[model samples]
Target chain A: MHESASTQTNPSPRVQRAPQQPKTADAYVVTPAIDVYEGAEELRVFVDLPGVAADGLDLDLDKEVLTLTANRAARGRDRAVTYKRRFALPREVAAENVSAKLEDGVLLLTLPKRAALRPRSIKVTSG
Target chain B: MWSLLHNDTMKLFDAFERQFQDSLAVRRADTAISFLDNGDELVISADVPGMKQSEIEIMIEGEFVTLRAERKPGAFEGFKLSRAERGAQKLVRQIELPCRIDAEAVRAELKDGVLTVHLPKAEGAKPRRIPVKASA
Candidate 1:
């Protein structure tokens, strides 16, 4: 007889907090795919939002909730659509130091960690 | 006889493996596209996010258009990937138009990771209005 076993990891508590969305039935809403990267100093997020211009992008951070909203214009037979997403920050970050840029329909966001949370090298003094 | 049976069984498994891979390729190549007619011209829009203009290839022949694109992994320096829903992929899609197209006048433009192809209708494919004449 052969025995097989598998274990499932529990979902993070922070990830359980679903994004708050209001009723919007006019235009189609899509949640763009995103990739999150973690570094010693900051966290980087890459969002795939094709057909969105810079003027149609909006980013806001209130408390620990970061929201991203992008509007795509109607083209040919394709109707206008809105891409909206929200994420709860896992760690403290410097709100004022966050930076974002869009290139080739990909949005890159950098969130710097708070000074107290950032890892620093300790210098050793010889006695 | 035993060796011959083994060979036949291996060949059957090889054929099944190839069929399974082909179906997976078809599913992965499903790119979103929209085709529309704009008076004397036709337009095609495809969503190809995170792909550069140079990474996409377009070929048009007669009434058929094919798009090939490759998206590389979005890797960051000095950073570790935490979550990745989108990964490197290769897309190939071929479309057949309803009517003939003017190959010489075909134009394509890529903006914001979307490829738009404008194809003009050929002379023979365009609709013509016939003038009514009263018999004297």
Candidate 2:
């Protein structure tokens, strides 16, 4: 069943990510590209971070912000590189239930909406 | 000796030539690659995230190594894109090595999102250490 018309009141939802800023100036840091998708039940995020191992990845979440950091190991003369980015959490997101997975150097984050924010159906009765 | 000086000059010219070719390759492919000339092997690494092993193609001919890969767009069912910075891309890079390598001994591995290739130096191209002997 396709019920997308009534699912989102706003056809286009604006993402509220904060402006990108390097945490430190002394290190070699880069910003990885990311893609965000929105569904009726949850929000999905995909981040490209090639060469970053699972052990070098870190995700931090609080009431307002979500921070992602990853470090790639040095190869020969190339020095170690760091990727850092931050995002502001949406109001309807269920922070406690958020899940993250990393595969083939891509990170996928699933943020489910709060129960109250989900759509509800009303039954009609004859007068 | 004059021969030794001529060899040094030729080596310098070769280095410059390789650098120019590498720069052109980078411009054409828009991809950054790292080439490390180890004592016995050359290690080449490139960032190719969101690509499957089967999607990458490697070709080696003469002294050049070529890499080709493509990244497909991430489209999900029943979902709409709110933001998209990582999109579909196709990359083709042809890099020349500083020395001859044994084509049969080449090894490649993909880990995390990085593709690494190890090219072993050819037997005739490797530097050999010689011992000096004194006789009475």
Candidate achieving the largest TM-score: 1
- All candidates' lDDT scores? 0.73, 0.74
> Tens digit of lDDT per residue, candidate 2, span A57-118?
88989774677888876678877777777666666678889889998888998988787866
Off by over 4 Å in 1: A1-24, B1-30, B132-136
Clashing pairs in 2: A51-B113
**Candidate 2 CAPRI-style tier:** incorrect
Q: Candidate 2, residue A2: CA error in Å?
A: 51
lDDT of 1 by residue, B74-136 (tens): 777877776665667577888998999898899999898788889999998888899999999
Q: How close to the true structure is residue B4 of candidate 2, measured as C-alpha lDDT?
A: 52
